[model samples]
Target: MAAVGWRGAPGARGLGGTWHPWGASGALSVGGAWAPVGCAWRPLGGGRLAPVGGARLPLRAPERLWGRARRKNPSDPNVEGKRRATIMKRVHMARKKGERIPVMFDEKGQPEGKHGDELMSWIGVLAQEHIPIWIQDWRSRDLDGLKDIIWKETITSFTADESFWTACIKSCGEAAQNFRHDLYKTFVEGFLKEESVWTRSQKVVDIYPNIEEEDWVKFVQYRTSSQFQQLSDRGSEIRTNNEYSSRGGRDGYRKLD
Candidate 1:
C-alpha cells in the first residue's frame, strides 16, 4: 500500500550500479574494467534507480505501476462500502443465470402493473398489524410478541393460512411492493422516530450493561439509515425494469425511468 521513489539510471557510472548492504559493497566498471568498493547504500525498496549523490531516478517495476492503477481512488469510504455491499447482495440473491421468470402482461402485450395493488394491500396490512408488532418486538425484545401479533392480525383480517404469512416474510420479493422495499423503509423510519425503545429494550436485556441510551440509539439509527427503504426501492426498480425490458416492454423502462 506504500510506494517509495529513489534517485538514476541502472548500471550507469558513479552510484548507478547494483549496490548491496552488509559491507556496503558496490560494483562499478570503468573502461571495461570492473571494480568493487565499500560504501553506505540504503536499498530503496520501491523499484527506482538512484544516483550516488544527486541523480534523478527513473521509475521501474511494471507490477508496481499496474498496482497503483488498481488501487482504489481516495474519496468517500462510506459510499464505496455501501456500493460494494449492494453489489454483493444482488449477486448473492440473484436467480440462476439464463433462467427466466414469466412476465405478466395485458392483452395488448403491454406490461401491466400486476403486483402494485397486491403490494399496496400487503403494505397496508403490514402497516396496521405488523408495524405494531415490530414496534413491540423492538420495545420488548420479544419474538413471541411478533409471532402472536402477526398470527392474530393477518390470520383474522385476511383469513390467510400459516402458509401465507410464511410466504410473505420468506419471499418478500413476491409481495406487491416487495417486502425489502416497504419493510426496510418502515423499519428505518420507525427506528429513527423511536430509537429509544430499542436502546432501552437492549439495556433491559443487559446485552450492553453500560451502553448509554442516547449513544446506542444514535449508533443504531446511523446503521439503519445507511441501509434503508429508499435503497431497496432503487434496487427493486432496477431489477424489475431490467426483467421487463428483457421481455420486450418499453413501458417498464418508461415507468421506472
Candidate 2:
C-alpha cells in the first residue's frame, strides 16, 4: 500500500489506505493529470451526432417537396390545370351536342348566299323531284333544242319595251353591233354551258315556263311586225297585271311574288 489510510470494506480501500465502500474509484484523483473514465471521455467523432430517438428525418430534395404535396392531397387547383380542364369540358360538350363547327373554304369553292342555306334548300328540293323531265316537257324540246329556245324566249320577253330594248342597246353600245358576241358573254352564257338537260334545265323550266303556243305565236307575230311597231304602239298596255305589280314601281327589281 502506497499510503493505506483505511479499509471500510474487506477489499475496498481509499488513496489514503482507508477502507471506504461508498467512495468512487480513487477519490477523483487530482495532481499530475487526471484522465476521464468510461463514456465521458469518448470522442464526438468528426463533430457528427446521431439523431435522437423519435421520428426519422425526411431525406428529400427541394424539388421533391412539390411532388410530396401533390401526392398528399392532389386536389390543389392550379390555374393552368383548371384552364385546360375547362377547355376539354367545352370540347366534350360540343361533341356531345353534335354542334357543327364552321369551316372556311378556299376561294375557288366559296359558297354564295347567307351561310349557303338558300342554295342548300334549293338543292334539297331538286333532289327530291324529277326536275329534268318537267323542264323538257315545259320547254317542248330535247337537250339540242335548248339554245334556240332560250334565245327566242329572252328576245320575245323583252321585245315589247322600246325603253328596255334601247337600254340594252345603249348598255351594250358598240357590243350590240355583234348581238351574238355580246349575248355569248352574258352571265347566262356560263350557266348554259355548265348546266345540262338533267340538272338546271328542269330548274329553269320549273321557274319560267313557256306561254301557250297560241299565245307564243301571237307574241312572236306581234314582236316581228313592222320592226316590232305593235310593241311600240301598246308596249305599256302589253305588260300583264302581274308584270305591273312587279315592275310598276321603284321596287321593280325585287323577286317576283
> Best-fitting candidate, measured by TM-score?
1
Cα RMSD for predicted model 2 = 43.9
For all predictions, the C-alpha RMSD in Å is 22.1, 43.9
lDDT of 1 by residue, 1-257 (tens): 13322222354322344442122345432223333433223224454533345333332321122232343321222333343344333333332342222324344432335332232233233432343312311323454555466455434333234544543342221221232233334334455566354554632334223335664455345446645447647766897877443211112222343
- TM-score between model 1 and native: 0.23
Q: How many clashing residue pairs appear in each of the predictions shown? A: 6, 10
Q: In model 2, which runs have C-alpha deviations exceeding 4 angstroms?
A: 1-206, 230-257
Model 1: residues >4 Å from true position, as ranges?
1-123, 132-145, 170-220, 223-257
For model 2, how many clashes? 10
Q: What is the per-residue lDDT of model 2 for residues 130-182, given as tens digits with 9 covering 90 to 100?
A: 12211212223353343333333223322222323322222222121122222
> TM per model?
0.23, 0.14
Question: For model 1, what is the alpha-carbon lDDT of residue 75?
Answer: 23
